[model samples]
Target: MSNLSSIYIHVPFCTKICSYCDFCKVLYDEKWLRKYLTSLEKEINLRYKSNKIKTIYIGGGTPSCFDNAFFEQLLKIVATFNKGKDIEYTIEFNPEDINENKIKLLKKYGVNRISIGIQTFNKTLLAILNRNSDYEDIKKKIKLLKDNNINNINIDLMYAISNQCLSDLKDDLEKIISLDIRHISTYSLILEKGTVLYNKKMPLISEETDAKMYNTIVNFLKTHGFCHYEISNFAKKGYESKHNLTYWNNNEYYGFGPGASGYINNVRYTNTRNLNKYFNGNYFFDKEILTKKDVMNYEIILGLRKIKGINVKDFYAKYKVNIFDEYNIEPLIKDKSLIFEKDNIYINPDKLYIMNEILIKLI
Candidate 1:
C-alpha cells in the first residue's frame, strides 16, 4: 500500500527435503498445491493495493519442481501484478527439476532470472546434504536455460559442511566459476534445530576453518571479475539481484504465501508457517509496528549487509539526525573494526566474519 515495488511469493513444496534445510516446506501433494495456490491468490487480493511492482521473486522449496500445469497457473496469478517494463522476475530452481518445458514456461511468463540450489559439486558432500546434483548434470541444465534466453542465473554455493576441507571448497568454486553465471550466492552451513542434519547431530566445521573459507570465497570471486556485492553474494557488473537488494536496502516489499515476511507502512509482518493456518485465511502470525527508532535500527542493521555499507549523508537525510551523533561508532572506527571512508561507513572487510559483534556495538 506504500507504493511497494517488490513482491516475494513462497512455494513451500519440494520433491525431497535437504538434510540441512529448515525452511517451511512439505512433500509435493496435488491437493495441497491447489489449495495453496488458491489461498495465495486470496491473500494477495486481500492485502495488495495494486502497486506497480518492479521485481517479483518466486522463491521456494524448489519452485521449478512443479509440472507445467501448476507452474503456468502460478505464473498466471503473478501476471496480475502491474509490472514495470524492466521488472526482474526470478524463480528458484533445483538442477534436477529444470527442463526444457519448465524453462520455456518461465520465459513465456517473463521470468528473467533463475536461482539454482547447487550446494556443492562434491559428490560426498552432496550425499551428506541429501541433495543430488553433479557437475555434468548442472552444466546441461545451465545450457538449457541459456538455450531459451534466460541468462541471468544465480547458483548457490554452500561451504563449511562437516568434513569439508579448503580443497573441497576450492573445487566447488572452480566448477561454479566455470558455469559462467551472472551471480553467485554463498552460504555457510548452520545447524538448525529441526533439520535432518540437526537430528543426526551433525557437527559443523571449525569456526577458524569457516572464516578461512569465507575469505577464500571473497578473494576468489573478486579475482575472477565478480564483484563481492554483499557479505555472501558475488555478482557480475550490472547483474546484482535487485529483489534481494530490496531487503538489504530496507525497502518495503510484499511477501505472499506461507513462512514469508514483509515490511509495509512501518509495520513488519510474517505469514504463518503452518499451511493449514495459511489456507484457512489466517495468514498473519505476528506483526511489529515499528517506531521511528526501530525503523532507523533496521535501516542500519539491514543496510550494512551490503559490502559498500551505508551512505552517511543519506542516513542523516532519512532520519534528520547524524548517525555519528546517535551511535558512538568512533570507538569501532578507531579500532579499525569499522571503516569510514568517502562519506560511507562499513565493517572492515577482514572483520566481516565477526560482523555481528561489530553490529552489537553500534546497535
Candidate 2:
C-alpha cells in the first residue's frame, strides 16, 4: 500500500541567503517568483496523484519573504489541491519577514502551523551567519504570531558554530525554553561543500564538544516536559510535526519543486537543483526504484531516527522476517548501544550522539 498523503513544495526565493545554507535558493525577486509559482503549479498538477493531502509543507527560500498580494498568489496556487479537514499547512519564515499583516494572512488561508527560522538568539552568531533578525526582533515576531492566534509554532535552533561553547548553548537553550514555543528543532551546523562557511575553511566544533552539546540539549528538553520525539526535534505533548513523521516513517510523498526529493511507487527521485532547468520544465533528473532489500535497508535507517526506534512486530509483519534473525542486532544490544524495551528497539539515550555509528553497525 502506498501512503502518498503528504506534499512538500519548495519556494526557492529568499530575501537574503545565509552563509551556512546550501539549499537551492536565490535572492527574492518578483518576476522570478511569479514564474516560479507558475512552474510550481505546473509541477504539482503534473506530479501530484490527487490524493487528499493531509499535510502541505511550504519550505523555503523563505516562504514568508513576499508581500501580502504575492503571498496570496502562492496560497491560491496551492489551494488547487484538495485539503483534508485538519490540514497542517506550514510555512517557514525569517523573523524580519514576518509582520502583522502577513501573520493575519496566514491565518485566513487556513495555515495552522508556522516554523520560524530563528537559528540562534546570539547576535554575534547571527552576524557571522549573515542573518538579520535579532533576539528582540524574534520576541516581537513571536508575540505578534501569538496575538493573532497562530500558536502551533516551531523554533529552529542551531549550534556547533566555529566559536560556540557549551555555556553559549546553555544560554541559548535557556532563552529558547522561556519563549513558550510548542516545538523546537536543534541542528548542529554542518559545513557542507559550496557553502560559504565550508569554503572559508571554518572549523567545526570538536567531536567531544558536539556530542556533549547534543546530550545537554536532549536532557534539558526532557526535564522541561518536551518529548524528544525525533533525534533533533522536541515537542510538547501532541505537537510533533505530522508532515515530517510521514518521511521518518518511510512512507511515500509528493515533492514538487527544484531540489525536492520524494519517494513514490517505491522509487526515490530528486528534482534537479538548477532553477533555470526547472523553469524550462526539467523538474526531475535523478530517480531510483528500490528493490525489496533496498526498502528494508531504508526502513531500518529512517525508522531508527525516531526516539521509539523500530517496532519489532511491525518489521516482522511488513517484511515477514524476524528482525533478530535477519540482522545481528543482538551484538549491538550486548554492547549497550541499542536498547530493546516494550516491543520497541531504539538507540540508547546516551548513545544517540553516535547514532550513525550504531546504524552503520546494525545495517
Candidate 3:
C-alpha cells in the first residue's frame, strides 16, 4: 500500500456567501455542480495512488448544500476510494443544510464525522457575518445527527468580531457547551483582503481584546471537559480531528477539486481556484518541490502547531538530524517562551498567543 492515508475533497459551491469568507466558492447551480463532479472524479482517478485512505474530509463551500441526488452522487464518487475499515470520513456543513434525508445518506455512506459551521449563536453577530442560523434550529439539527448515530460531531465557534465583548463570547461558549457536541473549533475573525469585511474596512477588535477572548475560550472549554488539542481545536477525550492532525503533523495527503491543496512525494501543490480553468482540466495551479532543508523547516513549522509540540526523537528519525543542533531553540527555552519537557518541545502555554514571533526567531 502507498504511504499516503488521508483525502480532502473541496466542494466549492455555497448557498449563501458570508461577508468574512474569501474561500473559493460560487452560488449553487445544478449545471455547474454536474460539471464540477465530472472534473473532480477524473482528477481523483488520474492523481490518486490508490492507498487505503484512513480519513476523508469533504470540506468547503458547504458540502451539505446539495440536493439529495447530487449529494448521493458526491458520496458515491468518494466511496470509490480504497478506504480503511475504521475510516474517519468527515463532511463539513452549514447548519441549515442538514436534514433527515441527508443524515440518512451520510449514515448509509459511512461518514462518521460532521463539522458544522455554527460560528456563534448570537443573532447580531450572525447578521454581521451574513450567516443564517437560529439557535433552536441548530439544536434540532444536532439532535437529528445524534438520533441517526452520527455522534462524532464538531461545531465551529468564531469570535473577535468588531464591537464584540468578552461577555458575548462567554455567552456563545455557554450555548455551545450546552449542545453536548464532541468537538469545538474556534477561530478569530480575520478580514482577508478582497473579502467584504476587508473591503468595507471594518475595524477589528484590539489585539488586547482578542487575546483576552482566546484565553477565555481556552479556560472555559477546559472547565467544561474539552481537551485543547491544537491551537484552534478542542475536543472531548478521544474525539480530536484525525484529518486535520494529518496537516499539523506534516504528513502527505490527497486533495481533489478546485482550490484544494495536497502534499505528496515531498511536494506541496494547490489546485486552481478558477472554475473556468478547472473545468478545462488545468488541475494544478502552483507546486513546490521541497529540498531536504525545506522539508525539515516544514516539519518544525507544522509540527509545532500541535499543543503537545514536536517529538524531538521523531524529528531525528525522519530527518536524520538533531533538531536543537539545527535550530537555536536554547534561547527560547532559556527565556521560558518554549518548554522542553521530557522528549517533547512545545511553546509555553502562556506564550502561545505570540507563537508566531517565537517561530520567526527559531526559523
State each model's CA lDDT, in order: 0.93, 0.88, 0.93
Structural similarity to truth (TM-score) of each candidate: 0.99, 0.97, 0.99
Order of quality (lDDT)? 3, 1, 2
lDDT, candidate 2, 149-184, per-residue tens: 889999999988778888888988998888889999
Reference-based TM-score, model 3: 0.99
Cα distance off (Å), candidate 3, residue 146: 0.6
Candidate 1 on 288-332: residue-level lDDT in tens? 999998989998899889989999999998889899998878999
lDDT of 3 by residue, 1-363 (tens): 255899999999998899999899999999999999999989998998789999999999999999999999999999999989989999999988899899889989999999999898888988889898788998999999999899999998999997899999999999999899999999999999999999999999999999999999999999999999898899999999999999998889999999999999988999999998999899999999999998888988888879999999999998899999999999999999889999999999898899899899999
RMSD (Å) of each candidate, 1 decimal: 0.9, 1.2, 0.8
What local lDDT score does residue 332 receive in model 1, on the 0 to 100 scale?
94
List candidate 3 segments past 4 Å from native. Answer: none
**Backbone clashes per model, in order?**
0, 0, 0
Off by over 4 Å in 1: 1-3
Candidate 2, 65: how far from true, in Å?
A: 0.7
Candidate 2: regions farther than 4 A off: none
